[model samples]
Each structure stands twice: as C-alpha cells, then as structure tokens.
Target: PVEIGGGDVGVGCDERGCNLVDHHRVGGLERVRAAVASVLDVEVTAATLLTPERWKSLAGSVGSVPVNLAGELVAASGDGTSVVRFPAGTAQVAASDVVDFFSFPGEVGGAGRIDRQRDWWKSWMSAVGSGKPDTNLPALDLDVIHLLGTVAGGRVRVPVGPWTGGEDVPTIDQGRLVDLVVAMFPVPIPQAPGLRPTVRLLNGTGDRSVDSAARQAVLRAGVELVVVGNYRSAGVIQTRVLHRDPADQPAAAALAAALGGGVLHDEFLSPVTDLTVVIGSDFRMDGQ
Candidate 1:
C-alpha cells in the first residue's frame, strides 16, 4: 500500500483499492483523476473513499508512517510498490507500481519555466477579474494537471487548503495556485505549423552559446534560419519577435510560439528579413 500526506490531505492505496482523505471537500479529485490517467497512460476503473481516521489506521496497520513534507520523499517497499509522502500532499506520480500514492503543488514548472508560467497565469487572472470570459483558462489547468500526472504514472493528489466559505477559503489567489502548479509540471510547447517562417536569430544576451542553441531549437521546430548574430543590445530579459511587414506577423507569431514566450512587434516599413527573433537571457534552450 502507498501512503501520502499533505497539509490535511491524505491518500492510501494498494493494488486492490485506494482511498483519499481530504480535510476540505473541494473539486480536486477530477483533477487528480486526470493526473493519474496522464501518468499511468491508462483508464482508471474506480476508487474507494475513506475517512481520515480510517485511512490513518489502515496506513499504520500496513507499516505506513507519516513524514515531513519539507522537501520531497519517495519510498519503495519490498513489495515493489512506491509511496511518495509530502506534508502538503504535493507528490508526483511514480513510474511503476500497482499501488502508489502521490501529491503535487498547484504550480509545477521548474526554474526558468516558472516565471513565464506566472506571467501567463497573471494575464489570464487579469482577464477573468475584468469580467472577461476565460473559458480557455480551465483547459490550461487541466492540461498542466494531466502533464504532471503523466510524469508520475496515475497516482497524484493536491491539497486545496481549507474551505470556510466566501473569501475565507484561502488568501492565495487561484492564479497563484496555477502558477505553482505550472512550476511543478510545465506543459510542452505546441508544435509550430508546417509553413515554416524564415527566422533571423540574434542573441540579445552576452552568452554567445544561446544563439547556437536557439538555432537548433528553431530548426527542430521546422523553422528556417536566415541569419544568426548578436542583438544591438545585451540587456534583453525576454524574447521578442519583430516583423518588418504586417503580412509576416503570422510568421513571426509562429516563430514566437515555438520559442514559448515573446512579444510580437510590427516594424511596418523596416527593411529587415521575414522574421527576427531576439533571444534574451530568459530564453530557455532546454524547453522546460
């Protein structure tokens, strides 16, 4: 059996069945289920719910013990089952095991990817707060959950903190939660269209190697490289896409999309090439 502990959320599972112990009843199981499916790459049949006390008792009976979620803990028993125990119930899925317990924070992207995800989440939250329709935001959350779930194998859980109704539910905003989740489990950049854009790559950062790395990334994404050099400035922190003509905006967007983050600028009557990509220090060559 696998035992997981997070804030107030607990999970215990074995090959025969599984259980979830949540202090605050919210809508996270569906997300958990999606994570499981993504990790295991298989359909989940069912799960048996149990009370916290009952789950604790059962866990104890099976040599399970609570541990601090200070960092990350992964344990495997002689039976070949793995259990990931965390204080906040934030554990990734394990690769193998008929029975496993896992939990993860709301945000899952690591290092360089976190900032971009945070910005993306902020944009969406701002739109939502402005009373604009954010139908696609929910899908993005699911996408992140699914991706994290797949990494761990089908057994994952997330604690939604306490629920006191109204504004007392949690001080942290949902956008922040999304940021955390994305930080923990970054999504893959979507592939650019086959109609590749001719790109002029320039390294805005002093790092000379980034230009070469960016070229390979652009090429892997099926984009054509017209020129490679250094930018006029060396202080760019974020990538940017400049199009000389309005007609090439789509091409610039496609190239930017492949790089994951960038601001598209219309240079209008400039005499540059088709598309230009200014690689900044924040440009991630590892992809995530």
Candidate 2:
C-alpha cells in the first residue's frame, strides 16, 4: 500500500529458524539485538520480520548448505505482496511468511552453528555490485531491496590478504586482498560510518610472526583492531575468538571468518575490547 522506511532488523538462518524442533535455536544470536543495533545504527529492542515472500522461503527452506552470503530477493511488487529472500537467491514466499522469515535466524546476519546465520550480510553488497542487474529487484521495492542493498554496499573497506604470509604477498599492507574462504567472487567494498566494531588480538603461540599475520587478516574482517599483543599462555593449540558480551558475537564471527576459522566463545567478556582473538599455532589460511 505505502512505502514505509524505518529501522527494521531482519535476522536470518539458512532454514529460517523454522526447524521442526528448537524453533528459536538460531546460531550466534545471543546478543544479536544489540549487535544489530550497532550495525543498523538503530535502537533495536527486537528483530523485524517480513512475510509470505521472505517468510515462506526461509521457513520452508530445504537446504542446510549456505548459499551466497549476499543472497538474492527476486521480485518486489508495488502492491506489497512481493517475494523476497535473506538477500534473495532461490525462493519467493508469501506475504505472511515475510515476518516469519525475519523471526528465523537465517535471515539475520552474523555468526552461528548454521551457515544461514553465519556471515549472512557479509557478501551482500559485493554480490549486488557485479554489474549484473535483476529487473525484478530494480526499484519498485526501493523501500526494501534497494535500501538494504545501499546499506550493505556501504560496508567498511577491509582487505583480505597476508594473514598467512608468503613471498607472493604484496609490500603494501593498506588494501584488501581476496579472501577465498568467504567470497568466491570479490568486489570493491564501500564504507558504512559509525558502526565499525573493535577487536583485540592475542598471540597465543608466542610467535610474533603469527601476530603479524593476524593483524594483516584484520583488514579482511573490516573491524578496527584496537589491540595486538600476546596471550599469556603460548600453549594454545587452536585459535579462538572470544567475547563476553553477547552484543560482540557478531564482531567475533566476522573476525573468526577472516582468520579462516577459530573456536568462537562467549566467555572472557572484556570492558576494554569488543573481541579478543587468541592466535593459535593451528591458525592458517584456508588451503595454505
């Protein structure tokens, strides 16, 4: 009926939090309400859901494997009864299920046990910027698809390279390198102001080189690295991304993804940092 614009947060899972059991069992959703507030620059007390289009797609989603992080939304009709997606890749749902999909974690963006929730918003803008156009997703639903595309396209510029150092690495430590782990297709990312999360890195292996490489990887995650130092114990065998605040889980997820992988933990909440990444000896770039 009318095009409305407001601060509405959509949480997603691959299956739309619509499991036969544990309906609310969304991954990494502990404090997502707050993390999303930081992400959307809104005072979000709760998540906003869509119906029919996005709802049914997410709820009735069949595959457990994660699709593109920057999924797709095919058609946005003017009458408001259009189909949608987490980002919009495969299905078109009913208007009623739109909000229901939003209720599902697959629609939400961030970390979790499932690929749907893990890194949902990570590749959205890049996917949208391929110079390819979707006629159905053009502008009729500017209220929804276009707006989200614009916001997602404004992600902070962070590079993904040299995390696992090699001779091929460039001398320049200032720009982004391709992270094959997260994105199969790479696009130049834009900027989103005032929402950058903070991070801290601890060298658990007691290896300065490991610390150096991880710092390089932070460029990929795009979050501000406030601290880079040592983990008290060098005995750590595996890297870890730790945050005490549930609100920081999103940041932890992003960092973990950039580092290729890490043991994500909700413990060790710190007033000084949003996330602490303890670099383990096991840390290595994918396929490195």
TM-scores, in order shown? 0.32, 0.33
The prediction achieving the highest TM-score against the true structure is 2
Say what the RMSD of model 2 is: 17.4
Q: Model 2: residues >4 Å from true position, as ranges?
A: 1-194, 285-287
Off by over 4 Å in 1: 1-196, 268-270
Model 1, span 1-288: residue lDDT tens: 111222323343331122222312233565445433333333444433444444333233223323222344445678989765433333322222102232222322231222222332333233333332333122333344334334334323343322222221222344444333333322222123224566777888989867656766665554556677888889889987888777877777777787876757666624555777888888897866
**Residues 5-113, model 2: lDDT tens digits:** 1222134432222221222334344344444333223344444444455534332332222344345433556887766544544433333443433334322233221
Given candidate 2, what's the lDDT at residue 172? 21
- Native-referenced Cα lDDT, model 2: 0.47
Residue 180: error of model 2 in Å?
19
> Compared to the true structure, candidate 2 yields what TM-score?
0.33
